[model samples]
Target: MLCATFSQIEIRGKKGRTVPVLLTSEIESNIDLLLQHREMAGIHPENLYLLPRSNFNSKEPIRSTDVLRKYGKEANLCKAENITSTKLRKHIATISQVLNLSRHDLETMAEFMGHDIDIHRSIYRLPQETIQVVKMGRLLSAFDNGTIVQYRGLDEITNYLRFKGGLLTLVL
Candidate 1:
């Protein structure tokens, strides 16, 4: 399907969920190359699957885990064995959370990711200690500056974090 400028391909994922995958130009070119190679090799024009097995008649899905791990080793990514679909999904979930979308927008994102908000956060959105430290520092700084929100009872905390104690130690 078409979206904005890039192409979006919808496919059935686990549990019959509809998953939309966007193809960048580089990935599109790679797919084109594969199709060209398949055509040159005299593969059946009516092949039912995109990444058909070497047998050509098997209905099995391509093993992207093996491909990703091999590519990771060649590209010097983290441990090759760690390259996996779940890792990629978790990365997308966790990274998208950093954009600070609204609750409604997050729900839309969760829908697009084929999961509900609770499952998305609990299963994929892993907590990073460094990120937590940075966010806490920023929150404390905002409170200290009285820029985030003005709450009556939070004044004590704000006053305490206004560089008086070691409560707010942000170098950013």
Candidate 2:
């Protein structure tokens, strides 16, 4: 996986929902470096594990929650409360709504987040303040300029977004 041009991991979250998460370039590089360090740490190919325990079988991962918490703390530069994985997931979800994604893109993103599209909309979409401050501002501007339309669904909103707000074009 380290030598590959791209890498992705399928994370089975709660409720048996699986999400294929693509690694960014920076994260991929870190993974490659980690694997190299793992080899240096005497974790042989016969018993391969990225985060292998020193005296335990290599087949099992080091499942200590503290490891996640440690990284969560480091990443929480703002010193926010309860910087857990769930917070990270929700942060990704809330911000993603403003991308003005097309219907297919939204579905793909929702599936990649290990939830149904409806769930994504109902629970993960940005709050009203964010929408009102950002997206709705653009909508209001377009409406004032007589460039808006009367659309009923997300797809129509996406079309309107294309001409008003810059839209996100996801390839993966």
Candidate 3:
């Protein structure tokens, strides 16, 4: 017998625009954990797995308004007068910086936080010495085949590569 690893379906908005929402393996594992917790709580094995309510107000079908009230309180923070999604996004960005995330990690976090990766990179990516090194590498690698001369040392090789004008054609 064979088993499948996992699968995903692409989600689209009402306008038919594809959303960049991709679930990691962690999500499926967390759902399995939730199911295990539900079974431990004495929910019937047959009914052990069930979707949360659209409003997610209860662990079970209870009429208590406490969960709803809590949700309302949290929602009030994003209310027009108090805070905006933009503000919340800025807070998350700051937290990402404080945590010292790398560029790839920041991209993942931005996706998790429902922000544009380009915007996150623009705001959070610091200019580092590695960027200059990469630029220099590109500059050195742009020479013609004839321009690549054998040299005694790495510095001489680098200088020969960086040499411009008729020096490159003369080597041919």
Highest-lDDT candidate: 1
Tens-digit per-residue lDDT, 1-172, candidate 3 = 1124444434443355444544457777886787668645555444422543323334444222555546657777555343444556676776455344567888777866656788777775546554444435443564444344443234423433434664542121
Candidate with maximal TM-score: 1
Candidate 1 TM-score, C-alpha based: 0.64
Error of 1 at 128 (Å): 9.0
Q: Among all windows of ten consecutive residues in candidate 1, which has the lowest summed lDDT? A: 151-160
lDDT per residue (tens digit) for residues 82-105 in model 1: 778887777888877655567898
RMSD from true fold, candidate 2: 8.4
Q: Higher-TM-score candidate among 1 and 3? A: 1
- For 1-172, candidate 2 gives per-residue lDDT tens digits of 5646556888667888777867778887887898878756656556655566645436555664667767767787566356666777788878777776778988887788787889888988676677657766666665677665553245424443443255432221
* lDDT, residue 52, model 2: 63
Query: What order do you get sorting by TM-score, best first?
Result: 1, 2, 3
User: In model 1, which residue pairs have backbone atoms overlapping below 3 Å?
Assistant: none
Question: Sorted by lDDT, highest first, which candidate order results?
Answer: 1, 2, 3
